[model samples]
Structures are given as structure tokens and as C-alpha cells.
Target chain A: MSAPEASVAVRQRRGSFGRLFVSELQLVFGRRRNQVGLVVLLGLVTMLGVALKVSQLRHPGARGGDIISAVAGNGIFLGFAGLTIEIALFLPLAVSVLAGDAIAGEANLGTLRYLLTSPVSRVRLLAVKACALGVGSLVGALVVALGGVLVGTALFGAGPLITLSGSRIGIGDGLLRLLLAVLYVTVGLAALGMIGLFVSTLTEQPIAATVATAMVSTLLWILDAVPQLDWLHPWLLVDRWSAFIDLLRDPIFTDRMVTGLWVDLAYGVVFFGAAWLRFRNKNITS
Target chain B: MTATRGAAGRRTLWLVAAGALAAAGITGLMARGAVADPTLPPLTPAELLAKVAAADVDGMSATFEQRSDLGLPTLPTSSLPDGEDLSSAIALLTGNHTVRVWVAAPDKAKVALVDGSTESAAIRNGNEVWLWSSEKQQAKHATLDPSAKPTPTATPMSPSEAITKFLDEIEPTTEVTTSGSGYVAGRAVYQLVLTPKDDASLVAQVRVSVDAQTFVPLGARVIADDGTDAISVAATSVDFTRPSDDVFAFAPPPGVEVTEMTKDSAPSGTEKPKGDAKEPTVHGTGWTAVAISPASTEKPDKELTTILESLPEVSGSWGHGRLLSTALVTAVVTDDGRVAIGAVTPERIYAALAER
Candidate 1:
């Protein structure tokens, strides 16, 4: 083929790949279950805001940097408080639903064969699905945070952010911290998403993949809580889930936050690597 | 083809061997970081107790480090006296802190908290006690009654006081034994371990380290039933030589706010009673002791009540109220306006209340 024709063919392939990623994102978010999950997450954030407001009204003098304490009188801290609450279970569950359904759901529906018949490589398909899950996780996190800020601001009214170290910061800096908190939570959940993606590749049944992913996440949380298992604490994936609290400190403690990010990155790399290796070699019988 | 395959297999084997070596090396370094147990003569429980009871040291200065993981809610700083540095008190309740203490028996002592870049010191010189906060540029003065005994209460501000208090409160209900010997602050010490006889007590063991030479307690550790250290205080460095008299003397620096506490006035915000509240009374004895106090008439503000309500509720012969239980401590607030708290279980607290 001539140079121009070869270049044109390469450009066409690139354009199609871009379209595939966008369509994958839309398909992931377009599902009824994922939509319901997003709504449920928002509902949880609202309920938390209401509970915190009621507690604040009852005890005006309570102190701490916990979710309830942060949202008591300062609505701007709602994003941080919401992130803390959701990162425990809701965020992981949401990410798992999308990632667990990524490949397995396609196979279960008998569409995997058709998708593979296209010019797309298995690696490219997996990458697109992973990217779709990543986008979904970030959106889920932001929805919860935005819901919390709206509900908390309406009820408590906006005020200066009071850090865990008992220092007051301006609204602009508080919002910036809130953004960083949302980003941190999103990245943390994406690590869980990677695990779900790996599990999804193991089974043709979407439900089994979803359940396995959630069970693994819950097991990590349980390991983190068992005080006697001090050795397991450092290696647990969710061990530093609450380290985001350090961000609310005046100087912003980054030791645990940095450690948590590294742990998440490690998990993401290993799980994603496993998923790629498995899918690359597996016979697409489904 | 076979030769190429053999070469690939050998490379993989080498990779695994290198990885295993790295893992073992990391584990070895972690193990090496742990404190090494030292060899010493063993003593009977009775002999160790007698030595500790008879132990007394005068005119010693030391830098003490304390770490507490009580899991208690952080108390509001606004509730404390203005410019009163209660970081030590907060540290005792929650995290870790370091302070330098100098005690010259008969009420001459000083405790300086080593905060970053600045320090706060509480000095007791004869009948006058001064608290100076360098960061806040504030000072508080209190005059002690000449006839009043020079108890540790005069300067009950250091973490060492907490350790000393624990050592002094050893009860007959504890099964005392010498666990082993170890080095602390570069001094050879004997570890006298005490286990609670009461099964209801949350404390699994309390370990006290006594100096082999001076018999003074160089360190104390409170281990919860869950095998986590709830509280640990140790002297990182010690000097038996007498602290200079100037160490205990203090004068307000220029441009500092000075507050004088009189006999009729409360010294700290925490000391002030809400209204008509009597001092808490101690009940029972030993490991299962409970402090029964009258519930405050002025209820905790809305926020605090919510926090209290969030705690699990327990009902029994003692009546229903909220119960806050941690690995090391349990606090029960009875419905009938009484609060019982100790290192014992709710059932033990209920039984003690029934006796009362």
C-alpha cells in the first residue's frame, strides 16, 4: 500500500478506538442498575447530612474531625465527610458493580463473540472497559460529594473550614482540599475497580464476579480491623481508607495518604496485569 | 529449541531466588528493629512487689515519652482554661507526647512539654506554682497552702505522674509476677507483670519496669485483653543528679498575660463544676474498681448527647443506660443519673452498682 493509504487506515483505526471508549463509558453508565446505584449513593449522602445536622442541633459543642463533626457547623466540609462515609462500602460497591459487569456481563449476554469479531484487539477491549469503569467510579464519587455539599450547605450554611488540628481555613482553600479529597477517594475506589475487573475476567457469570469482588473488598476491610493481626494491617488494600482524615489537618498530613496511594497503585498494577494476562490467553468460548 | 527453553527456565529461577532473598532481608531488618530482651536474675512475685513498694528516688530528672490509645473522643480545647497548655492531657487521652520532668522531692519539680519549636512548662517552687506557655505568651500562678502536704498533686501535669499513679494503685486482686528483664533508657530493669484476677477486667496485663539498682519504675505498659498496648510511658533518658533550684523557679516573661488562681477560684476550666455536682466516689477495689459519679444536671449539649446516644445501650440490675466499651476501658451511664467507669466489663460495673 502507498504511504497515504497506510496512514489513512491507521487514522481510521484510531478514530474507531476513540469511539469505542466513549461508547463503552456510555454503556456502563446507561444501565439501570448503575443508575440506581448512583441514586442510592446520593441518598446515603443526604441521609448522612440530615443525621449530622440533627446531632449538631442537639449538641452544639461537640468536637472532633469526624464526618459528623466536620459537617456540624461548616457545610463546606460536607464533601470530605461524605467521602469518608462512602469510601467505606458504598464507593467500593459502586465501582465493583461497573467493573464486575464489564467483561462478564458482555459474555453472559452472548455479545463477547460479536465484539471480538470486530477489528478490536482483546487488550484494547479490556483497556476500554477498564477506562469505562474508572470514569464511572469517579462520577459516583463526585455525585456523593456534590450531593453532600448541597444538602449540608442548605441545612448548616457555609462557613470557614475548621481542620482536625483546630485551625480555621478560608473557603477557597477548603474547596481545594475538598477537591483533593474527592480525587483521593476516586483513585482509592479505582483500585477496587481493578480487582473487580480481574475477577470479572475469571467468570462468565456477572453475578458471581460481582459477589466475588465485593467479598474480597470486605475481607480486606475485616483484616484491617482485626487489631491482633498487626502484620496484615500494612498489606491490606483498604488499611488506609480513613487516612483522608489527615488531609483535614492544618498542615495536611500526607504520609498515610501517600502510602495509601502507593498501595492502591500496587494493587491496580498487579490486578490489571493479571486480568490482561488471563484474557490474552483464554479461549473466548462464550 | 530445547537449549533456548532451558535458558529461559534458568532466568526465571534466578528471578525467583532474588525475590525470595529480598523478602527475607526485609523481614530480618524489621525483626532487628524490635527491642531485645536482656538477661537478668529472676525474682519471685513477692520479692518484686516488695522491691517496687520500697522503691523511692529523690532529685531525679528525666525525659519521658508517653503513648495512649484509649479511643476516646477528643475533648474540646475551648473547654480548657485560656492559654492553659493541656496538650499533655489530650496526649494522655489520645496520641503520643514527650515531656521533660525534674522532681526534687518535697514539692520542688517542673514538667516541660516539648512541642515543636516551643515548650510549655509547669514549675513548682516551694509554695508557688507557675504555668508558662511559650507559644501563647501566657502564665498562670497558684499559691499553695504552706501547711498542705507536698503531694504529687501539686504538679500533676506530666505523663510520668500517670505511670507513677498506676504503679501505686496495684491491688491485691492482681496476680503479680516477674515476666522478664529488659533494658530501658540504657538502664538494666526487671519487668514486673500483673494480671487481673477479675475475668471481667479489660486489662490483660500491666507491666512495670523497675531499675535493678534504684528500684525506681523506669517504664509502665498497660496491655488490653485484645493484646494491644493501651497506654505506655517510659523514661527515654534519666539523670539521678539533683536538678538545679533554678529549674523550679519561674517568673512571668514580659508581654505575657498572667492569671492568678486563688483558693476560691477554680484553677482550670475542667475543674469547674456545672452546678451542685459532688466529687465522684470510688467503689469496689483492685482491678474491678469503678468510679461512680453523679450525672451532670446540666446535660451535655445537643452534639454530645448524640455522640452519647450513638454508644451501645446496656440494661440489667443496674438499670439501662448507654455503654461505651473499648479494648481498655468501659464507661456506663445509668439511666437513674449515675455514671460508672473503669477497666472492668459492664456486668462488673452493674454488680458494683448493685452493691452500692
Candidate 2:
């Protein structure tokens, strides 16, 4: 083939992968179960906001220096409190649903053979699925954050925000920090999603993949909580899940948060690499 | 097909090998990053102590971390109304904390204890002192006598302040020696090891790292006899330059509750009824000393009572009491209400109570 024709063919393949990624995202979000999972996440956030508001009302003068107690004073705290509660269970559960289904669901439905027969490379398909799961994780975190912020503002009303440093900040700065927190949480969930993606490649049963992914994350959390196993906490994926609380401080402690991001990146690399290797060689007999 | 299959298998093996190599490389890199001991001019224990005494630092700002592994049971705070404060007070004796401090020397200092989602700060500017809690949205201010010496409350927030208490017991009880030189908070420092001469003492040793040039203490650790860290406080980062003046200035934030306290007036409910309160009596000296506070007339809280009841019961010539023994400290609480505590063995505490 001539140079122009060869270049045109390469461009066409690039465009096809772009379309593949878009379709993958649509496939992830359009499913009824995935949509329900997101709504459930939002519902949990709303419930947290209402519970905090009710407790604040019941105990008028009660004082505690936690995110839950801070919710009464600032509507902004609802987002913080909700994310803190949900990250341990609901957030990981939601991400697992999408990530565990990424490849396994397609293979289980017997569409894997058809997709392989198409012009797309196996690695490209895996990348598209991973990207969709990344977006899914981001959406899951946003559901909790935005849901909590809206419901909290409606209940407590927005005003000058108080930082953990006993100092006050304007609403604009508070919202900015909230945005950073959302992104930080997104990275953590995405790291867990990578682990789920690898598990999905290991099994043709999406249910098994989902359960295994959820178990891995839960195990990390369990390891993080045991004081005797503290030496292992730094290596656990869930160790810094709550480090987002540092963003609420006046000077903003970034030591743990930055380490958390690095930990997430490392997990992403290792697990995604494992997923690619597994999927690249697996025979799609189903 | 067979040829391609063989190639794919080879590729898989190569990739796995690469992954393993990468993991090993990263682990090796991190292992190498453990800092080596920094060399400094050698000094004897007495010279180092004198240097710390004469050292003067005008102003600085720093962040520090304190960790205590006292091997105490988790306090039952779930059912308590003042659970946050109760747990926070207990957390000071156990677990880990990060603190930010700013000192402008003569009468201007601020220490912010940063916990999970809240901060409590104590700021002293000239004759005025402020205690603020972000969680409660409250600030308490008190004006001190201008003529009184500028002695802030004794807070073990810094390595210098925390180590000073142990340094006071440097007489015959502590075997002082210079272990070596090293680095703390990125500054070259000398390690002064204080080993308790008494075998009954639960403390194995106390190690303080003093800044080589300035002689200011930058880190300290208390090792228990069981080879565990009882308490470790260190400056994670530091800056010796004077902090900005605005950091010392304080005006209560708009929404916070401001309470002005009069001179010499303790907060209501905190002051014990004067005549009934007996001063704590000390039995022994230095590391093995035990302080016994007489039985209180006031009723102990239900939570405190529950905690006390959970301790192991012990009876001897001292009479029956609950004994709480940790790696670094032992406490004996008699049924009649006397409590004896010291960094000594349980038998020593029991013996002290019997003598009393």
C-alpha cells in the first residue's frame, strides 16, 4: 500500500478505538443495574445527611470534633461525612459492580468471540473497558459528593465554612477543597477498580468476579483496622481512604493524601498490568 | 498456529518476569531510602545535656508527630456523651497525633493539635492566652498577671518539652550515655540515651536527639522493658526562621463562642471542693516513684467506674484493689479510692500501696 493509504488505514483504526471507548462508557452507564447502583449511592449520601441533621437537632448542645459533628454547623460537612462513611463499603461495592463486569460480562454473554473477530486488538478492548470503569468510579464518587452537598445545603444552609484548624474560610475556598476531595476519592476507587478488572479477566462468571473484587477491598479495610497489623496498613489499598479529611485543615495536611495518591497509582499500574497480561492470553471459548 | 501459540507463551513469561523485576526494583529502591546514620562531632552525655541547657532558639515553626503504644485496652467511649473529649484525652496516652507549632520565643507561641477532622489550638500572645476548639466552635481567653514569669502550660507536644521532664530525673537514677549521632527532622543531631538504673522501672530507656549546632531537642523516644516503643515524639519537618507576626495575632472568628475567663478563676465544675481534696503523696524517687492520690469524695462517672471494674482484681497486704499493668506503667487502684501509678512493675506499685 502507498504511504497515504497506510496512514489513512491507521487513522481509521484510531477513530474506531475512540468510538469503542465511547460505546464502552454507554454500555457501562446504560445498564439498569449500574444505574441502580449509582442511585443507591446517592440515596446513602442523602440518608447520611438527614441522619446527621436529625442528630444535631436532637442533641442541641452536644459537641464532638468529628466530620459527623461538624455537619450541623456547615452544610458542606455533609459531603465530607457522607464520603467518609460510604468509602468503606458502598463506594467500593459500586465500583466493583462495574469493574467486575467489564470483560467477564461480555464474555459471559458470548459477545467476546464476535468482538475478537472484529478489527480491534484485545489490548485495545481491555483499555476501553478500563477507561469506562475509570469513568464509572468518578461518577460514583460524584454521586455521593454532589448528593450530600445538595441535600446538606437544603437542610443546614450554606455559609462561611469552618476549617479543622478552628479558622473560617469563604464558601468558594471550601468548594474548591471539596472538589479536590472528590478527585482524591475518585483515584482511590479507580485503584480498587483496577483490582476488580484483573479479577474480571480471571473468571467468566461476572457474579464471581464482583464478589471476589468486593472481598479484596473489604480485606484491605479489615487489615487497615487491626492495630496489631499496623505494619501492613501502609501497604493496604484502603489505608488512606479517609485521608481526604486532611483537606479540611487550614494549612491542609497533604502528607497522607499525597502518599495515598502514590499508593493508588502503584496499585493501578500493577493490577492493570496483570489484567492486560491475563486478558491478552486467555482463550474466549465461551 | 502452534508457532504463534509458542510466541504468546514466551511473551507471557517475559512479561511476568518484567513485572517481578519491576516490583523487586521498587522494593529495593525504597529499602535503600532508609537514611543512614549521620556523622557529627562526638560529645559526652554531660556535655550534650549542658549544651541543651544553654541552647537558645529565638523563633521557629514546625510540624511534629507523636505516637504512643502504651498497650492499654481501648476505652469504652461508644456509650459516653462526652465521648469525643474522653477519647481524645485517652488518645493522648495512646495512638498517634500530628501537631503544628509556631514559637516566637518570649511569650508568643501556638500549638495546633490536628486530629482526623478537627483541631484544638492553644495560642499564647504576650499576657493573653487562648484555647480554641474547632469542633465545639468555642474559644476561651484568659489574661495572665504581667509580672508573672512567661511559663506556658506544660504540654508534651514538642520533643524539647516532652524530654525536659525526663531530663529532670538525670541524677543517680538515670544512666546517661551518648549512643551515637544521627539525623532527625533533616537536621544532624546527637542521640542522648537515658537508661533507668532500676530494674523495677518499666521504661527500658529514653532516647533524645538534640540538634548538633543549636542543641535543641528534635526527637525523643521512650522504650519499654518489653522492647516496644512506649512513646515516640519527633519533628517531621522544621524551619528555624521566625514565623510571621500575623500568626501570633488572634481575633475570635465570627461564629465561634467566646468565653472570657477572669484571673485565677478555674472553669466551673472543674475545680474540686477545696477542703476534701487531699494532695497526692509520692512514695519513692526518680523512675520508680509512685504518686498516690487519696480517694475522691465526688462520685466517679459511670464510664470511669466501668473502666476501673474491668481491671484485674488483686489482693495482698495492701488490701484488695484492681491492677492495671501496661508495658511502660503500672497502676493500683484500691477499693477505698486511693490510686497509685508509676513507670514500675506491678509488684512495686502494690508494695508502694501497702507501705502507704
Q: What is the C-alpha DockQ of each candidate? A: 0.03, 0.45
Q: Model 2, which residues run further than 4 Å from truth?
A: A1-16, A47-65, A69-73, A117-121, A226-228, B1-33, B50-61, B77-88, B104-106, B144-169, B185-188, B239-250, B266-276, B294-320, B335-337, B354-356
**lDDT measured at residue A137 in model 1 versus the true structure, 0 to 100:** 79
Q: Could you tell me the lDDT of residue B154 within candidate 2?
A: 63
lDDT of 2 by residue, B37-68 (tens): 87677887766877887788878888888989
Candidate 1 lDDT by residue in tens digits, B275-307: 545998898777777998876665556655667
Alpha carbon deviation, residue B1, candidate 1 (Å): 15
Clashing residue pairs in candidate 1 are A58-B302, A58-B303, A59-B301, A59-B302, A59-B303
| TM-scores of chain A, one for each prediction | 0.94, 0.97
Q: What CA RMSD would candidate 1 show?
A: 12.3
Model 1 chain A is weakest, by summed lDDT over 10 consecutive residues, at A61-70
Clashing pairs in 2: none
Candidate 1: chain B TM-score against the reference chain B: 0.72
Winning candidate number (lDDT):
2
Query: How much TM-score does chain B earn in each model?
Result: 0.72, 0.80
